[model samples]
Structure formats: structure tokens, C-alpha cells
Target chain A: MSTTGGAGSTALVTGASYGIGADIARALAARGHDLVLVARSAGPLGRLAAALETEYGITARPLTADLSTEAGLEAAAGAGLGLSFERTAWEEERRMLALNVVAPSRLVHAALPGMLGRGRGRILNVSSVAATAPVWLGTSYGASKAYALALTESLARTRRVRRSPVALTALVLGHTVSEFHERAGIPPSPPSLTLGSPYVAERAVRAILRRRPPVVCVPSVRYRVLAGLLGHLPHRIAALPPLADDFTVTSYGAPQPSYGTGEPPAGGPESAGGDGQDGVLPAEAHGQRERQP
Target chain B: MSTTGGAGSTALVTGASYGIGADIARALAARGHDLVLVARSAGPLGRLAAALETEYGITARPLTADLSTEAGLEAAAGAGLGLSFERTAWEEERRMLALNVVAPSRLVHAALPGMLGRGRGRILNVSSVAATAPVWLGTSYGASKAYALALTESLARTRRVRRSPVALTALVLGHTVSEFHERAGIPPSPPSLTLGSPYVAERAVRAILRRRPPVVCVPSVRYRVLAGLLGHLPHRIAALPPLADDFTVTSYGAPQPSYGTGEPPAGGPESAGGDGQDGVLPAEAHGQRERQP
Candidate 1:
């Protein structure tokens, strides 16, 4: 694969219906990438694909598969026709593993050969700060993120040996104003305390462009320091009842639902069509979404 | 459920065939605690139990069961027929979670009531230094240990709130002279470079008694410092080419046989009785049969 610096690359983003994933999709498209957006909801993906295609002139394909299942991942990987676990009892757990671990692994694996053949590519995994935190409230979510972090690290490490320009970047995000909080069942913080979607999107894109291995707690240096310090502290000190209580309250008050039912806000950029002949939208169209006033 | 200080108590240890697990069992026994030793192979468990009972005058029991599967953990958790994997998985996961994220939690849960009632108790989890390091190579093992570290921290945090004298300690260990290397298909380094079994056993016992939470690296303080450094470094730098090469070589060099095998050296500890009381063969005799010269 020949590595090109930029402007003609293809990017595939999962969980791209909305929130950080949507923002990432937009950012990559703006930077001239052909996009494949994956999520369970078809409504948002279609909206996103259309917006990207019209606005940025990039090909944006929407794949509405529940990515947390083996079959879903296998299909996404283009491995073969596989059975879906839609009727399985352990569907929830299996889906989470498949989406968070297996799908990403397979997608990266599948995309790597092509990326390598082209000589340059970037895989930006939108991971959460929960990966490093020891809070138990979001156990599965945190563990899966940890797996992503490790996998990304491993890929980044090994890629150097292969001399591939495939950059694996994990964005360790904190609370951003997105559907994630709503899906998680947690109320959004006051406007001053919350992060905006546009800013997060911009930073994520920059990290990928710059090939940062991992970004911990974007826009807040203090939180990053705190996470690092907390991770290193003695288990006894960290486990102190008062501290644990404080941490649980501060870092994990409640789970927020990450999905929302909605259409993209109207008057946004048009959905772009197939391939290279498309024209780029003006950068000013990337406006911030309104949240709790 | 009542915790008496180290004055008198009992602990049941699984996977006590050899290596760190066995050393942990011995360490607890040496502290005048009664012991229940469990392993799939009855031979070493019996022998180790016998030696501990004979030397320390502490009662020792041996029961064989594989811990990774439900049937095994169920037997060890006691034959209460009402056990459900749903509740039991949570409970066991909570306990071994530190073994994986939940062991320290369960220990604190179990030890707190007793420790609070008597105003003192101690629980030590034999964790690896790998808990903090990136698991680029030893993925499952490192992930499990990370869970251990998290649970330990969670419990330690809980201690401060309850004002309980239940001390939770995590002995973050490095490479040592043990069968773990052999089982994991790791070749032993030079004698001076490894922590002798006796040394680790004694140090672990002392740390537990003192309620110290130490990130330990056997034989070299350098390894602890190195681990600390690696844990904080950005994912990219930590996964740099040379480091990745070194890690991959060391971690995946020799393939390990599956976890359990019943065979033991002829006329050695593996031939000992199941009860543990009558298997106190001399250390020299056991060593000659088990260790390669």
C-alpha cells in the first residue's frame, strides 16, 4: 500500500448516527475523506450520509447493523454470510463485545490491507475516559473501552514495524454535549461545564491528522492529570470510602443513554453523492448544536 | 463472618498447585491462618497443604476444582444448590474481579462485616505488575490483572467510608522463581535476576500483615520504575517499535499448554494424600523431583 499524506483517503466510523461518532464523520468528510458510517439506527445514519454527501461531496454509505453481535461484525468485516444473534438470550452482552471489541478488530483488520496497499490511512477510535477510571457503575462500558484502548495501543505499536502509515488514534473523551449522556440516562451538566460537539469533533480530527496515539480528557488538562494520578494511587487510598464516594459521584453519577430518536436539524449541508467529483462545503457550515439552555 | 485480627483466621486458596498461588496459600498459613487449598490437580494441593499444616500447626483442607468454569467455582463457593450463575457470576465476578475487577470488592464485602465487628481484618490479593502496564502481548492475563487492580482500589476506597479496620492490600508483583513461568511458557531468567519463591512468600506475608499496598518488582526496583513510567506514557510512545518488539518476544515467545494437567513428578508432592495432613515430605525431596537442576 502506498501512503498518501491526505485529501484522497477513505474513513470508516462506527457508532456514527450521532454524538461524537457523527461529529467525527463530519470532520473527516470535511477533510476530504470518503466515509462509511455504521450505527443501529437507520434514520440518523441516512441523515448523516446525505448531509456529508451534499455538504462535502464525499461518498457516505450508511450501514444500519447492530454492531455488537458476531454476525453483525462478520458481515461488516465482509467475512461471509453469517447468522445474526437477533434472537439470542445473551444478545446484549454479545452485542457489546461484538461492537466494542470484535467489530472494531475486524474492521481494522479488513481496512488495513487496503490502507497498507495505499500506503496511508488513519483509524480513530472514539474511546471514553472511562477506560482508565476504576469506577464500577459503568462496568461493561468501561471494560470494553479498556479493550479498545489496549487494541489501539497494540496496533500502533505493531504498525511501526510493518512500516505502514496506518495511524491508530484513540480519543479518550470526557463528557461532551452529545446523545451519549441522554442515552446513558444522565442529565447534562450546565452549559458552562459541558463540551460542545463541534470542538470535540475538531480536536478528534486534529488528533487523527497528527497521529496522536491516544488523547485523554480533551479540553481539560486538569481532568487528564487527575485521571493519571488516580490511576497511579495506591488501591487502599483510592478505595477509601469517602474518596470512592466522591469519585463515584463526580465521575459516574449515572448512566446516560447514548442514542436518541431524531432527524438531523434541517437547513444543514446537502448529502454528497459517490466518489471524487464532489465539491467541498464551506467550513462555516460546521455550526454548534444547541443543548439544554 | 466475624473477623478476628491475624490472631486466628482461615483462608481458602484456589489454583494452589504451584507458583504465586501456592506461595500465597503458604504465606497465609504461615500467619497462623487455617488453609483450604484447591486445585484441579489434587497432588500438589495435598502436598502443600500437608507441609503448611505440619510446619505451622494450622489445619489444612484440600479440594480439587477448576476455577475458570462454573462447576469449579460453584464447588469452591460451596455446594449451596440455590446458586445461580446470574447471581453467582456477579458475586464470583465481584470476588475474582480483582483476580480479573471484583476480587478486592468481594473481599472487602466479606471482610468488612467481620472486620467491623471485631475492629480488624486483612485481605491480600496477589496481583501482578502487569495490572498497570499495557497488555499489548499478554492480553487476557493483563486484562484480568487490571480488573484486580481496579477492584482493589475500589475496595480500598470503600474502607475509608466504612471506617472499618478491614485492610485491603494489593501486592503488585513482578517475575519470580515459580512454575508460573513454566506454565505460561516463559523461560526462567538467571537466578540472581528472579525473585526466589521463599523471598516472595515472606515478603507477601509481611506486606499483608502490615496492610501495605505495594507495586512490587522482584529482584529489581528498576522494573517497578519502568512499569510506572510505561503506565503513564502516551499510548504511542509506550507502543514504540523497540518496546513492542521486546514485549512481543518476551510475552508470546513460548506457547503455554492449556491451564490444567493432572500429572506430577513421580514420588513428589503430586503423590501426596488428599487431606494435606500427611503429605509433609521434606522440601529437598519435593524440590529435587519438581525443579529442573
Candidate 2:
């Protein structure tokens, strides 16, 4: 690891309380970077901060705020930003826009100038595989992610126009084992999604620091291949817009069924609800029914 | 022409006073869709509304409002919508987000459900070719277009999830001959930008009405081929995140220099100053400079 940060090198990571974000925090801490960990809930963030500090001997401070509201942006601006997800309702849509789209932009807006002045900075925005195209979900989530990728692209360009190499990388991730879906009350993505989260953090950090760096990085060889194919697939065939298991038009207050791995479990339809518990529909799962056409 | 709207087919167009947006309003009026022409200024919009009403015999209402504000969205919500843009300023960036990103999403939010209920409707959002990847522009315009395209993609999926074929088409436009650059105080893209605005409007309406329309329609044949290639080009190569002309990093208040169509202009840099009355960079005017290799 080039370990970009020196004795006092500091990093700001949002959504640091859990899942892929938590793993990223651990990884960064190992790299000897002091961290300002941001998330909504204080308990988990606090616990994670303590653990990281104790384990890696790096300073970790947890800040609890929504990150989607004006106050959230202000707080995050004072600190710095992770990202990711969904639901309906105008309220839900608004929240998704603020968190997934606005917050990250604001956080980056805040932290970027300093890095540019110093002539070296790295920003890793966590986006989903679903961001590349549309998926069958509420209208806002994927769009929000698309906003992130676009923002990162624009900012990176902004830096480049000035000949600044302060890097901004979009981590176009495939599904992984994170509390992401489960915490929202939806089923977990089927195992077919990815090997798991440990690999994601390790690969993401590596990609962000590569010599030429990257505009976007899809971890896991399988997903890298899939992302490449998806890019080339005819737009019509490649995109599978809004649909859930029962073919219901999921909208405000609809039952949101997550897609699972396509292979039917030995226990039949009884095994794969995507919940990692029950109601499994392996064949339809294809593991990626959510995004794959 | 399937001129779908009769009793209430009022097509509200933002930025309707000039450029591609004005052309679209003209085309829609020609197709028998009543028009609600919107722009920041009333004079031009009023004149166009009168002219369209006189020429096409369709109702044209000129509604002047700053679409970057809440009041603007409220006014547009009461009417219906269309879109288009360029430029930069902190205020300009906010307005760009409001118009290009927020406005379209809001307009769609206001108009979509009603269309789905009727089992038909057409939404054509004007986005840029630059949106496919990043360009060297130092602003929010490209990112906002990205937001529009992603929103359209998700909404298209939403309707499909319900099996409702409400048409949603993202017009992925290339640089066209319009007052766009002039209005922004920048030189016109060399004629190579694409066949200009007249083609842009006519082709856009047609694409939105195709029996099997595409999620994104790059208006010209050349651009369509290019968009296809971009989708397949290695992501690293497809996106060139920095620089317009000099390897200088342009900024908010800095003097903005115009990039020629990648060739030395015949009249030298002097002939390319932006206005129609002066420097015309047409023959050598490839609207966009290919990313400096």
C-alpha cells in the first residue's frame, strides 16, 4: 500500500457505522489514517470508532447526523462523507435524494478544495452496480446513485481541467454481504451477488490507489466482466426497469421483495426469499434480477 | 403524427423562449399539442407564443418564471413540461441543478402519474452527449443531464413495472446550432457538433413517439454510433475528466477560453468570439474538441 497519509494524514468516511462502510473504516484505520466517521445512529458509529481506534491505534471519531438535511450537510461539511439505497413515498424519495445525491456532493464540495490545494487527495464514492443502468425499484435510489457517479465524474473533470491529480473514484460495486438491505427490512441480496464485503473493501482501496487510478472500479473479476458486458449490451435489453417478484407495480407502501440468486434451492421456493431466511426464488433470482435485464 | 393531446394535452416547455427548447415547442404545437411556453423573460416567450398560435393554430401560453425556485416548480406543476441549457456561476450552478436536474424530476413527478392513469403520455427530457461520460466543462450542467437521464430511466421502468406504456425519452443531444453558446458568452461549437437545432427538435419528438422507443436517443446518426461506441469503450478511455483548451484548470470567475473544433481556426482565434455577427467558426467548427489524447 502506498499509504497516502503520513503521521497526521486524516480521512473522512461517511456511513461508517456498518456494512461495507464499516469495513472501509477498518481498512483505512489500518493504513494509519485518522478518521472522522459519520453516520445517522450514534451507538454503532461510536462502537465502531472505539473498536477501530483500539484495533488499529488510529484516532476515530464518530459524528451522528442525517447527512441529507441542511444541518446534515453542514455537519458533514465540518467533518467529511460514504454512500448507498431506497423506498417510495415523496418523503422517502426526498430523503434518498438528499442522502444519496446531495450529501455526497456537499461533502466532496467541502473536502475537495483543501486536497486540491495540497495537490493530492483521494475520494472513493460508494455506488451500487444498479447505478450503471436502471433497476426495478422505487424511482429515486438508482437515480440518486447515478447522480453520485455523475457528480464524481464532473468533479474529477473539474480537477483535471485544472491539471490537478487529486483523485475521485466511483466504486461501482456489485452486491455484497452488508447490513444495507437487512437494516431496511428488505431481504438480503442472494449469495450470487458477490463473494462478500471483506473482498470489497480490500479491492476498493487498492483500485483507488492504482498508478493510473480509475474512473470507476467494479470489484470481483466476475462483476468486472459483467459490468463490461452490461456496458455493451443493447440499451433496451440491458435495462430492466421497475419490477419486483410478483410483477406488481411497486410504489408508495408496496411490498418490496428483493431479488435472490436464480438457482432454486434444494428446498424449493421455500428457501430463498432474498431475506437469506425464506421465500427463496432462486431461478428468478439469477441473483441479479434487480438490475440485469 | 399521433398528436395525442386534445382536451388537456398542454405541453409546458421550460427555457422555451429560444434555442432547442423553442424548436421543440414549435414541433409539439405543429403536432397539435397545446403549448405553455416558459422562460425567464416574457418578451421573447410572448412573441413565440403568439407566433406559434398563429402558425400552428394550437394554444400557446407564455409563462415567465425562474424555474430554479420553488415558485417556478409550483407554476410548472400547474401547467406541464420540456427542458434544455449551459454556463456557470455559483448561482448558475444552483439554477442549473434546479432546472436541468430538479426541474425535470419535479416536472416528471407532477406529470407522470396522470399520464400513467390515461395509459399514455410522452416526456422528452433534453440531456447532453457530454452526459454519456464526463467532459472538461467546469460546472454542474453535465451532471444535471446525467440526473435527468437516470430519472427518465427509472420512471420508464416504473411505468413498465405496471405495464403502463407512458413514454419517457431522454434526448441525449450533441452540440447543436442554437443561441446556446452565444447566450452563455462562448463561441459556437464547430458545425461538426451535430446537424444543429432544427434536426435536434424534429428528431427528438419522433424518437419519443416510436412504437418501441429507446431509453436514450442520441438525436443524430453520427452521435448514435458514437454513443454506442462510448458504451463499449473501456470506461477509462471513454471518460476524459479534465481540460477544455489550454492545459489550464478553469475556475468559477476565471476568464473562460473557448476551445476550437480541435483544429487551428482559419481566421485564427480572433474569428471565434461567440456572436453570430462576428467570428464564425463553422467549417472548422467541430462543435466539440475530441479529448486531447
Give the per-residue lDDT digits (tens) of candidate 2, residues B172-280: 7665553433433444456665355656667866665565556677777778876666545654455443213211243323323232222111111111111110000
Q: What is the TM-score of each candidate against the true structure?
A: 0.63, 0.75
How far in Å is the alpha carbon of A184 misplaced in model 2? 5.7
Give per-residue lDDT, candidate 2, residue A205. 65
Q: What is the lDDT of residue A11 in candidate 1?
A: 63
For model 1, the superposed segments whose C-alpha errors exceed 4 Å read: A1-10, A41-43, A50-61, A64-120, A130-151, A158-163, A178-193, A211-293, B1-4, B40-43, B46-126, B133-144, B159-162, B178-193, B211-293
Candidate maximizing TM-score: 2
| Chain A TM-score relative to the true structure, per candidate | 0.68, 0.73
lDDT per residue (tens digit) for residues A1-293 in model 1: 01332655556665566555567678878888777666656787898899999999988887766543435552221110011111112223333444444455445545544454555666655444545664322123444455456545544555432355556565555545534334333343344435565576777666556533232324466446655765677644654443333322344333322222122111000111100000111110111111110
Q: Tens digit of lDDT per residue, candidate 2, span A1-293?
A: 12243434666666565555666667777777777776666777888899988998988877776554667663321110011112223433444455555555555555555565666667776565556765433354455566667766666554352366566677776656534344333354566654565577667766665554576767888778766665556545655431121112433233332222211111000111111110000000000001110
* lDDT of candidate 1 over B146-168, digit per residue (tens): 44444444444432423554455
